[model samples]
Target: MADSSSNSLFIKPIYIAFVIAFAFLISSPIGSYAFTAQNVIDSPLLTKKIGTNRTIKVDINGNGEFKSIQAAVDSVPEGNSQWMIIHVRKGIYREKVHIPSSKPYIFLRGNGKGRTSIVWSQSSSDNVESATFKVEAQHFIAFGISFKNEAPTGVAYTSQNQSVAAFVAADKAAFYHCGFYSTHNTLFDYKGRHYYDSCYIQGSIDFIFGRGKSVFHNCEMFVIDDKRLTIRGSITAQNRKSANENSGFVFIKGKVYGVGSTYLGRAKGAHSRVVFAKTYLSITVVPAGWTNWSYVGSTENLYHAEYDCRGPGSESKSRAPWAKQLTKEEVAPLMDVSFIDGTDWLPAWL
Candidate 1:
């Protein structure tokens, strides 16, 4: 030891630096980002095995069991009770795909959202007709795929035609690491008890709609302005018409951000229920937070609420008077995975 005092001074500075760093690590936004990254990295739905090992491969090239996705789906027996995996290869499938109600327990797996896509260009007065991907089958699961409606963005309020990317109309459906992209009416979440994990949904108007008792976990909503619309677009249009419906859309630990302004949700029915819990709302969200245009009924039963949310847009001062900042007790039942009975039907590894 050259000098005991000199050694003491050197160690002291290093110790103090480490202590400061630890404090910063615990207090900074890095902690939140780390938690989000952990969810993405440790998703239980990414497992190779969904339920059974029966797999059908669909490749754009002539290498797999089928050349087209629909062809592979047709190959599956009519009333499929066993879990079968339809693995789509890394390519853009420019076609419409639908899973009928008769075929249940099917898992549609793709290489990745960035690599695999189902693309269609259609716009019609009928919501079901414009959809690119439709799932009317119960007990269905999908992973790492993108469903996109490439229809030309139409004039906002002038056109009767609507473009829907995906129509999920059956119960017990789950999606992991998926994407839905469209200009308007992107995800017509018609009706179901659904769970979405680490998914991205982008749209302009009424992006996520319908009366689904669903839980969106770690999902992202990207809103773009419909320049033609005189009114701002809304992220959701949940149409729970009555208190006894047991239907609502609950978004947990997600983020909403994008170019133009939008509301968290709109009251499409007398009892339109929606909750945003522990979510990050960016400045893209309007200060009104929620809207009730065209809904002429009393607001007493509307369950539009936010809980423990953060970010500039989460500020409550200017939010609509009808919108609620729920107490912890009020939000407890909605936060758990049991809200959609996910634990019972979700993957065993999850």
Candidate 2:
């Protein structure tokens, strides 16, 4: 037999196996409590509000029914039509939550804005997997919640990253008193008729992007620099495949200001469209106000327009020829909440 001193130096085989398994569990995104349609069904509804639209409670301290938001979402039944309210307590949650398309009419209610935060880190290369929160349902509403992607520029990300904080592919979806923060593609308004009222979005380079038909009312849009990689970045990168897509971003009565020079947007899709009416643009916006990614067949047909904008960056003299200076008549339809069809779905509380 080996000497006792030599045997004492070796760690238990079980301990070595445990350490390897623990490392793999934390780093690998796959095979780690992977969510699927079946997992959602297997989970039981945590708490159901009695009378009016059903309500579920989520508290981080274990006071509520569920501890995590994703568990609360999984508790909901598939094809749920009634308004299921998710009451989230004030706490910082690190989770990648997805509200599948089958679960509709989810109302995320937080105790207060800026206090309840859901954060994650994902890069542009990860594609849709990078979103901290993604709602693929319909008729959804969020009140007083902040979604963020905490991908640091120097360590986790470089100049060209597409980290997304939130992705909403819901129709007639509305957000009130919320905050979205990230560096690249913060708010992916991908495919839907959505409304953002009294909300905040902070980012740089194609932050408020996608093909959704969206309207921002009394919201705040801030452009931030990614570790000084580029002097400027585009605020929006709308991807409208064709003219009849019925997709665009309308910022009505919002403030756009922040560090470093940034353009209003660059065309990721050929028929990309964005309009700013009765909004504030700070000097951080480059005088040019627009940039074409310069790809063949792209940006050539982009529709970037502004009307009644008031700020040092709103001067139309130096703007690109392709961008338009619309008249009051041209922006009437967009000024109303009807642009996102909110008249039919917006709650009376709004």
Candidate 3:
């Protein structure tokens, strides 16, 4: 009886060691069950402070060394800072801002939505090849501000082909309670992953165009034109590059209104895809919801789907043959937190 008890005790220690070793293996990066708990715990804290706290408020109207937004951004130390907040006062600042990768995790907060505006007029087809506000900084956030591309509307077929107001080339960026105003290609999601919530974006002719993986929640997309105009233009032109890139544009719980006649969206690239889920579409959306952008061969690869969408434009029978009506089960994985949940390193509601 004593021999049996000793043997059991010896085996219990070995079993415990084995369990611990297995757990360590499972938690490693190569393990299939690798967890991000440590990452979440180790993420840099984001708050409103400078140097130590990471928030640097910039009141353009206040008495400070920096007057323009660009000057304030240039003043901040690069890479060493994590989260920097620029509190812009109520004023119309006509300037082009560029945020480089070296200045990541910068949050631009304005006094009020309509009160602070960044106004500029530039077109992609024009002599200029860059956007009015170009962002290459990851973990960037912009709220309570307006990015206006002041190009005249309805001047279609001109050399000023693609005029973009704000171009985001940053990963894990978010825009809340902001407005993007432009005539064509308003919010350019160049090549990155982003989230936009409760924002107003207006444009015509593929205004919301990009090759980025992005999600827009509870946003308003206005298609502008006069009463006599027909074929206003598509709202989005998602030009995703690769199949493995998770490259697609998602519009959830959004309202689409058109002052003139136009289709909702079109797949501009071969592998481009878009999903309109739980949205309200106005009669401005064309009968055939998805357009090919004059590309006949790309119809098979592009995946344009809709789920639980309502309004005068949500007529599936008249939709394009290429478009799809996704099942509830199919969209379940897409709605998970991980897809849109970036490091969660930024402040909440930013």
Each prediction's whole-model lDDT (CA): 0.88, 0.81, 0.75
Q: What's the distance in Å from true for residue 346, model 2?
A: 2.3
Ranking by lDDT: 1, 2, 3
Please list all clashing residue pairs in model 2, or write none if there are none: 124-162
Between which residue pairs do clashes occur in model 3? 49-55, 58-87
- List, residue by residue over 212-305, the lDDT tens digit for candidate 1: 9999988999998786767788999999988789899999988999998999999998999999999999999999999997789788889999
lDDT of 2: 0.81
Runs in model 3 with CA error above 4 Å? 1-55, 60-62, 126-130, 154-158, 226-231, 343-346
Per-residue lDDT over 8-116 for candidate 2, one digit per residue giving the tens place of the 0 to 100 score: 6565676788899888876665545343212320002212321245679999999999999999999999999788889999999899999999998888888656789
lDDT of 1 at 18: 96
Q: Which stretches of candidate 1 lie over 4 Å from their true place?
A: 1-28, 41-49, 156-160, 348-350
Q: Which ten residues in a row have the lowest lDDT in candidate 1?
A: 39-48
Pick by TM-score: 2 or 3, better one? 2
